[model samples]
Target: MRRRGMTRRSLVASAAGLVAAMGTGGDAAAARTARSVRGGAGGESVRNGGDESVRGGGGGEDRFARGEMRGVWVASVANLDWPSRPGLTAAAQRAELIAHLDRAVGLRLNAVVLQVRPTADALWPSPYEPWADCLTGVQGKDPGWDPLATAVREAHDRGLELHAWFNPYRVANHTDPARLAASHPARLHPEWVLPYGGKLYYNPGLPEVRRFVQDAMLDAVRRYAIDAVHWDDYFYPYPVAGQVFEDDAAYARYGSGFPDRAAWRRDNVDRLVREMGERIRETRQGVRFGISPFAVWRNAATDPLGSDTRAGVETYDDLHADTRKWVKEGWIDYICPQIYWHIGQSAADYAKVLAWWNATVRGTGVCLYVGEALYKAGDPAQPAAWQDPAELSRHLTLARDHEEAAGHVFFSAKHVAADRIGAMARVVADHYQDRARAPR
Candidate 1:
């Protein structure tokens, strides 16, 4: 999701307002509470169990009752969270990153999912792709320091897990290939790129493109000590009105045996997930792989196994990501569904979606960490529920009712720091009373 145009000053002001709303003794009390929660919540140890197939149904042991996956996404795309904006000095950028890590530690959070490869570009020196434009405002120009490497080291030192987030197919926000760095893989191999819905994406249907993207992402896995490799819900771009993905050629070439184009597309994504999981294991054991997909898989009206929601987009039908299937098949280590809604909304109730996911991963050993919309907490355009400071905290309380709910990861770091309307602060007061370790 795109970030709101809230300024840093405004975010700080809102955080102050939150403190006032909390009626705390002041910053000192808050700091004390944060420190107190740093202790681990005792329970079963959940670690990466390799690629073992996790099977069963809703009735099974809750393996992650005490563990948690508290994380915040440090988005680099469009400079939503980190770097403040493009073109900052390398020292300034490093300071900004350190501030974010410090903020996580103060909040008693245990993980930071930093977007190292925002748009098929590298935050580190990758032989496969150019430097990310978000680093220096010049796609191919090095920012003079290694962001992924520094992030991993600093995070581990702070006792926070650093998950390297990557967007596999997105090439650029714009459609102009000439605007990209000359060394950009998308520009060099034009046939592998597709301009769709005003953005450029590497064609997922091509075998070579799939393999190349994996190699590019794995380059970081091979270099850094990142706790996990995370992907957002951008597998196939969300459907645009009246526009088509225009993968006719790739489909025709590789879609021979599949019954239809939709099935073929799903298979393409499945291969990417399954193959990436295998390759990640081959590259580094104990390095987890996870996807934070759009909440709804399918509406019950669409399928019997689907959630009881009327979401506009279904990951199965629109994005072609069989997220539920991935969990059942044990292709990935964990599943964080972006249930970005309120407790009792009409379309996709946060509780309902959480319950659906809780059931989906019950018997499967895949951990369930709810993806929260902290960005929506005080968004004026959001429903009234989000305006209430207690909305997000209520979500955590509701999630506590579910046996399979391991933890939660907020949308982007800005909102967590923003604490707009004090929602995030309220969440900490209500639910994050105890510091928890990230589930394996």
Candidate 2:
């Protein structure tokens, strides 16, 4: 992405706000400095550094505060991020994993959201699901060692928290399950899944389906030493333009009190999220529960209290995800909004959404971590804001204004590995160079 350089007019406009606040008094000046530092769209460490250096704060092990979380997503589907070249020897896989962890350790990041079960498959040994095809050339053929166990063991060795990322409702991503290995879950339990929007997803409205997904996922949580349980933005599969999610039968049978099909669909997800949180605590108290939902929940046009964006599809209306409700109700430990846009874009402005999220997370203990769009930072089609090396830098700086904004987690690991436009160097040199805050 080719971003525009910071304009003098924009800088002056930003300074004007700071100056107005500072003119009040010494206390106001300190607050203004903190706000100005927080208001920039820079990296978190750089923004936090201004706060620390300005206040003449001391640094030590004390800098690593308790209850802080920072991580990157390790996607397995299509080999999107890690395990760079697929079908590499087991030794190569292990080596690549170590290198990724080394970067995270060097950056002082505390967590790795590795995709163990990208689809309805296994990254570790399981009787219920077959081995992930993304791992080995063919499905059901093991890639050698149990990936989850190896990932957990290796991550712990380097003092990094490993979160087992799971796609709760997704089955065969795009291809038909008849094309899948005979032993794949979708083939074995065709009745449990429904094909929708050119992809197969476990019928969310079915109780048996819900229980099965939880059982398949919780098995890993109980067996592995994972530090957190993570689910991403694919809650009911982002709505297809014209096609509807084929869950009519599941809802007709399951829906009793719900008035409409939409409400029933949302309740199914609510059940899964609420029940999953309770179950995680029941199984592993220390393992956190987090969801990175779509950036906009709803636009103010739809709801009076919604965000000021004109996003056509929102998590609340289109995807049946009450993301803000979950955070307000304390159903999740952390909320990572995929605020992947520029400063003044018409749809889903990054800065506006970040402020909305910070304000929404006011009373709840839920932590807010802006999910960086690392992939777009160098892509040609991305907005002008992403091209600037300092675009993401300014984002993190802006987020620091919120006390609840604990830290940041970029989308995937490989993009940063490329060091596109020196984005990685800027982050490490500026902030993560120091010791990280301790785990909660």
Candidates' lDDT values, in order?
A: 0.81, 0.72
TM-scores for every predicted model: 0.86, 0.84
Worst 10 residues of 2 by lDDT: 48-57
Cα lDDT tens digits for candidate 1, 1-440: 00123332443444355446657644533332222122112111122223121111121222233346779999999999998998999999999999999998777778899999999999999999999999899999989999988998888777788889999999999999999999998888999999889999999999999999999999998887777899999998989998889899999899999999999999999999999989987887668789999999999999999999999999999999999999877677778999999988999998889989988876444667899999998899999998999988888777767767767899889888888799878877766655555654
TM-score of 1: 0.86
lDDT of 2 by residue, 56-125 (tens): 0122233323324557888888788756756888888888888888888777677788988877887888
Q: Which residues of candidate 1, in runs, are more than 4 Å off?
A: 1-66
| lDDT for residue 309 in candidate 2, whole number 0-100 | 94
Best candidate per TM-score, number? 1
**Cα RMSD to the true fold for all candidates:** 13.7, 10.2
